[model samples]
Target chain A: MTVQQNVAQATPTINLPTINLQGNHACALGAVAAGCRFYAGYPITPSSEVAERLAKELPKVGGVFLQMEDEIASIAATLGASMGGVKAMTATSGPGFSLKQENLGYGMKAEIPCVVVNVMRGGPSTGMPTRPAQGDLMQARWGTHGDHPVVALTPGSVEEIYQQTARAFALSEKLRIPVIVLFDESLGHLEETITLPDVTEYENTIRKWATGKPEDYKPYKADADGVPPMARPGDGYRVHTTGLIVAEGGFPTQKADVVAPVMKRLLDKIEINNDLVESFEDIDCQDAEVVVVALGIVGRSAKKAVRELRQQGIKAGLFRPITLWPFPTKSFRALTKKAKYFVVAEMNAGQLILEIGAAKVDKQSVSGLNRYDGEPISPSLIKQAVKEVLGHE
Target chain B: MTTSNKKNLEMRFSGAGGQGLQLCAKIFSKALIGEGYHVSMSQSYEPTSRGGLSRADIVASGDTPDYPLTTELDVLLILDQAAVNASEGIIRDDATVIIDPRRTKNPPQGNFKVIALPLSETAIKLGSERITNVVATGVIAALSHDIPLDIVEGALKSISPKKFLALNMDALHAGVELARGLKTA
Candidate 1:
């Protein structure tokens, strides 16, 4: 969710945590909003509603919805159709999302633009059918093996869920990369009153094409912004995409010279597009002695807890990363100068903590308030951890 | 700034799932927000979908209310016994507790005042089980005196569909009437 501090509006907006549309149907509408023409998600807990809704809604706009053989085919088919010059996506929970990792990496490697919605469930293996967790935040970044780039956004409201889904696809297509829209089980099943905006940006976004003369076009030719124009198979641009390292124009080559820059470009696109790829919300952290870092649904709990601590005259703040990858280093690094204590509160034992450790270790006191029993990490525990880290307890 | 009596009012509504209690909570919060006050709402429920502990707590003040206040509430609306018994100990001295007498036999403990009204039973008599939340909302409107009946009625149609909308509207009227009768008594 975008938190715009509108000083000029001057209406004294209430402190109510703004309401958003729920997660599952939000995914369906997001896909539609992002101009996705193909969806193939298998039924899974906390995420099945998305598939169920898309099955009913996809046809009205002439999009395709299929129940593929498995999660692998689910992504592969979506990727293939997306390469055919249509925006595509797949939705799944933990197990299925885990299953799609192999193809997900392939899609990243091939620079195939698409969106994947992981309606996260509590899991090492199907831990809970209807619960919320942030364990997968790290996994969403590193689940696929090898050097990969990821764009992830967590929605704390039903409205953000709907809008983020669309935004994820737009980023995927515009940057020619895959994006993971993270919504856990609790969010997927949540029912709320969401005001659907009549005007939205999803209607206008990048549409990959089979452009230029079929005979003269080099399929991988970099455009001014560095993304090469992609052409479909039957477009006669004579292009090929593979999981293996391929040379320029997508041909199998042994020379390092041919394969190196494709990898560089794939990684570079995420950097060039970092501003658009990232999203977050900040609380009163200025002059805060203790700053708590969190993501996904647990982030909401952090916001609540911070408010309570501040009331007691405790200088506690919440630093949340909406875009997990291309980590919010600038903000965190700057924060360490002012903040003395840092706490990482996520659902897993200590997954996202490693990143905080990487960002800054000796700079401040770092700790984790982790929960893995299929329950949400409450704010009181985080506040207690903050107090202890601050030497108040 | 003139602090209306609503500035100090905080409320908790508890009921079973499928009873539309959460929707009612949101509508009441929206109505209060329309009055230009601070409002925050949160709901807790299990996965059962039919019979479960579903509750929505709304905190409103001239300024922001402290984090999901748990110590003592200014007002408590309980649709069942579990709510009153669960929260009976925490309400502040002189705070008001409203319960659906049909659901709970035990009176509230502590220094808090208690009002046992069969709002749900009255709502059932008015025609449907769905209107129970709307009636409970009216009981709240009476106790807090923060939200207007017109605002709550408008919120009903805005949230529910056309088919069930009229029933909830009448349910709101019946709720306001019952509160008025209690006020005179």
Candidate 2:
């Protein structure tokens, strides 16, 4: 907080081309760039900067920013705003992320498009507010109850945080599902200099609004893509949304036939379009015999380890999934074709590694290098893991 | 682990909380990035509002930094004895150590290059001890060509408040002069 502000220059649009910024600030600015017009959240450590920055910047762009009483109301307000035809978002850390789960399921069930940025910290319950952890990886995918699909993106750097936030918005809007931008405490607080590309560099997607006659519109009706065209309230079209099973006419239905397709479409919207939602980074992986699978800040360290192993004449590589959910199983399977050994490095106790093993990538060859401590996984530890997995000289 | 062939400079600025160590690291990092280098900074602080240990580790390189954390420190600037103790086993043999001799009565015996500067006293002489971090940052800019003094001045000008701009600039110049006067031998 003692860091002085930049000189009194006119506050340009939050999307400045070049700046030194924290990862949390980058998410807020990226939200603005992606045409996000509403933000609602209860402040929490590591993730609070996004809410704090958006509270100030959103108003300047003719948007709405609200500080809700709790994480529950925060996500509820975000869902409400998104239903009202605006790109909306809410951010919170571990405990708050847990509190928002029920509403997150509500957003998913109702097919509301919004973003939830979870800056992760150590937690079973208020464990370590200031330290970094990937404890929420599995929680993010399965936190909310029931069977529903969601997209979650993990960023390793401030610049990637910015771009991934914009992508989260685009994906959420396109898929009509709440997208989670996962951030570890280390990444959320990291400060770095980066050059943001021009707005033309990334495409932005907005939800399709019903263009049919008001009387002919069905709020829950699906188009060819299996996503319903949304019509905001007061738009002369029926706009009923509920957590209960809903019919295509936007009315609650008890019939099994009506409820089954509705639930099916909710999952199909993301699962069927998995190719569009999945994103992963392959570093020195083409000819690698040893592959280290990592995510978020741990992935950055894995990249360094891979570079070091390569210098030692060991064919090591890094597989980092930018999108955590949907698990990017196809990419891991692709790597298994060439890899002789797999070293899974994560800040959690074998969360994503289990998923890699679930992909059937030779369980005998996959080694779990787990860390649940509050500290980050160092590149040296990862290199040591690689050496152990490969039994190299 | 085998090290890479990349030549990158890694530095840490440590002090008790409220010493403005994070701000000093940020100013130096921004200046290096302005000179067209890739820079990443990571800082760890006490969970409380203030008064515990605070440190900011920075990695700056011509190429993008693959590992953003300070795996090995090339230079360390400590403001107090606690910082000196905190850095006991981490300081590399060839690294440079710049310390304020008033707070740290005895510098550690090591193969690293050590330069003693009374940064707090110098800042107090200029106007206030709050600018000691700025004074230390000035010494860092002068010690290496990686961060030019002009760029640091420019960075400080933009980030420092108008109320302390003059004093902070003076503190920075004083730091540069202090470092310039020192001889390695």
Candidate 3:
């Protein structure tokens, strides 16, 4: 059968009801709230609920949901759907995430805006299908193999996943890049009560479509803000997108002068507007002698540890980076200067600590509490890390 | 995490699969949430979960819980000996332990306040063997006082599938009555 037959046919609309949901389901509904009309994914554990829910629900919104043969094709079809003018997304776990990296890079280089949800599971290669881990921190940034900006957001609670997934779409569309929403299996399988936000709460952001005559269009042209307005394939605008470095006209170019501007614009779109993408939560850092840096579910445990330490009259704080890719360097640098030491706690051996050390000048000032045995980093472990960092009980 | 008399409660419900332990956990969690408590519930099944070990836990508190996983279980509700073994290292010394005496003839040794009831036998006598979990939840709600029986009933009314709603409610009420008798028994 031809690939054309693989596309899903639209079905009748169904009511979107508010209910207590798992983080994976919340991610699917959140994407729908953010105007995702196309979902192409291959089911992977812990992340499978996202694909399963979208398959049944997308058609209700007059959207298309396609289950591809594999992870590579899943992302490819998603990119194709996005280029066809629909807001698209795909969800996967670690193994599938690794498969999608090449295309993730293609989506970045081609400036196709999309959202990729990684419901994180343990390990190198399908290590633990049902276990939770935050080992993909560096992989999300450097996984695609080259210097490219990545916008990765992690949500600790189910309710926060809804908000963050929607925000991921907004940031992807506004910046014309792929945004990754990381939810560990711990959060993905977690079921909790959440009050669904009204439509007004989540602000939607759509890319500026190219205007004027088709002949005047420069598909790779950068606006003053370094983001070029996008045009769909059938929108009467001649758009050329490729994995190769190209000029303003979107055709491949080998000349350094032409390549320099395109490369610079791609990086500048995110780095120059870093303020718009940087987000973090600071807890009790003012009087803290030691600050614990963490993200994902570890961040939640860290917050609890910080509060418990405070009750014991130990000055401890939590610095949680909601946006993982850009690193939240400037704000964390300022926050670090006030604290005597930093403790980086995550499920992986030590991924985010490198960034924490890089953000602050001294490497010795930062320590790491790592767990890779397939369990979440507990609060007491973080409390111990804090005590060790402070060299006190 | 609260410093008041209103404190967080850590609970675990474990049984052989097909006893509806997952639904029991859900009903209890929803009841607590309805009463304005933040509850995080997680369930895990062994590789042989269909006929083997199935366990669910809930962390309920007036304040939002930072860690969803239960560390030191304040209450342990076991329907079989496997559950007692599963909960060996987790229960606090002062924890309130509830078990199905039919399955656990001789209870494990602990410094806990033990409430041994015929959970499965009671449900089987009520004309259904599928609702031992709901009955156990009723006993739990009554004993813990963190979630009210009426609230759990309301949660059941909303969440339980219509066909089995009546049977589940009956089992739940039977459990509530059983736990109430323990007050005087």
Candidate 4:
């Protein structure tokens, strides 16, 4: 279905009160609605508003909000909370995201279910704090180190930010992995009037809890879905969790034979359950000559540009991945089968385009429209690039 | 650059930082939301505590806009010269632009209608120069066909802090008078 139809179906027909909500604020609310009871974060630009809003909203719901000393401690605290059997989250920008990598890696290796929000900003260091950039597209998937299961979502609008933030928590809990929600500073700060979904209507997905004999339980043992039931803190199940590779007994082991299946199960969980983990939006791609691939704010710009191009009788389409990590390759190829040319428009200097090139089935002509000076890619820029690629006036 | 049939009205409240440009846009956004129109507000500013280019834009439509950011402006409010160049090449031909002559030395020169008003001067006369944003908000509300004066006043009343309610109301009224005077002349 088209993006417009998806939006129409998502909006409830009932008369719901609409309010102007910033994207960051929507994330905080979404987390609260998703039954996230613990938040640990260090405030940074573009992403600070998420913590700020949660500081006010969490207390009302009897949730714990922490202003940790640093980003590392922030993620560490968030992981600890989740291990204690609570849905937890922490938000940060580029510099802090770099600092939290080690703890984020720990969360991944230990299979701690938590949500990490990274509001993309211009960076290698503390580079342009207030400006927006998509430079972290590759880093988000690989920053935590090793061959680990990664789930990162990219939301384009404020409404999608809310929906995806909730989805991040659900996915993290269900799969027992750290789910990252990535959006640039532009979408983080943008406010729009939207009727938020009723929190009561959300079916919060709680993690599978350990049952039966406490002595017989093993922490790393996998079910048919490859996800092991987590032992609750007070449930008397003797559980051992660590950052090192471990066997089904949850004991650290370096023996290659024993570690092999343990590692494979960790990676196979996401791949086997791809149905629940993948989401994307395709707009007018059925009979198009050029298909533009983008996400986040750049995706919204491409959507507008594609609409304008179609008005001028240009057969242009847009394929936007709501789930950034894992790339949604299977669906992308299936949706854009007839397209001859592809353009990847992003705020950074060619990060996601690399994945697009690798994911394409044929040797279709692929080009990029990249802007890294911290300004967002506008619709006019995308339209001009599409025209140039198509050799049109 | 073709306009769609959708009533997508775009407006910008721009000036140097600490001028409450965001508050101006928020008040209008609240008013538009109350009128059953969907509003998308986005802002851009420097990383300083104060005194840099700051702008807040609002795009209102009957339905959620496909793109929320402002590409072509229908109305523009410039409180400082720092924000003048930011609107270049994007102002629509039939747009209404209001500027503070005391703060902006050279505004954009175009086919759009430019009304130079004493926005900051009016706020100074009231009490503080910080309320220049409120004054500008009033002028925009008065000149805009989509927003009514009473609804804008109600929004200002609801959003303004209790301590500054009376001053903000006075500033808003003075702004409406300035726009009305321009219309009469």
Candidate with best TM-score: 4
Candidate 3 structure quality by residue, lDDT tens digits, A1-393: 000111011222245343568888889988998899999999988799999999889999999999999999999998888888788999999999999999999999998889999998889898877678998988999999777878898887887788788878778888889999997988998876666654332344688899989999999888887899998676799877789998899789999998887888888789876866888888876557898888878888887888888889988888888888888888777766678888999999999988887788554488889999877888989999899878785
Identify the CAPRI category of the predicted complex in candidate 4.
medium
Clashes of each: 5, 0, 0, 0
Chain B TM-score for all candidates, comma-separated: 0.86, 0.91, 0.90, 0.96
| Candidates arranged by lDDT, highest first | 4, 2, 3, 1
Assess the local accuracy of residue B102 in candidate 4 as a C-alpha lDDT between 0 and 100.
Answer: 98
Worst 10 residues of 1 chain A by lDDT: A1-10
For each candidate in turn, the TM-score is: 0.78, 0.91, 0.90, 0.96
A183-233 in candidate 1: lDDT tens per residue?
A: 777667654445453214555778457587877776666665557778766
Q: Write the per-residue lDDT of candidate 1 for residues B132-158, one digit (tens) a residue.
A: 888877777765656777777666668
Judged by lDDT against the true structure, how good is candidate 3?
0.82
Candidate 2 per-residue lDDT, tens place, A274-297, comes to: 777888888766577888889889
After superposition of all CA atoms, the RMSD between model 4 and the true structure is 2.2
Q: Of the true interface contacts, what fraction does each candidate have?
A: 0.05, 0.70, 0.50, 0.72
1 or 3, greater by TM-score: 3
RMSD to the true structure for each prediction, in A, is: 5.5, 5.9, 7.0, 2.2
What C-alpha lDDT, on a 0 to 100 scale, does residue B76 get in candidate 1?
Answer: 75
List the candidates ranked by DockQ, beginning with the highest: 4, 2, 3, 1
DockQ of each: 0.13, 0.64, 0.48, 0.79
Q: Which pairs clash in model 3?
A: none
Question: Alpha-carbon error at B107 in model 2, in Å?
Answer: 5.4
lDDT of 1 at A101: 95
Per-candidate iRMS values, in order, are: 5.5, 1.0, 1.8, 0.7
How should the candidates be ordered by TM-score, best one leading?
4, 2, 3, 1
Question: What TM-score should be assigned to candidate 4?
Answer: 0.96
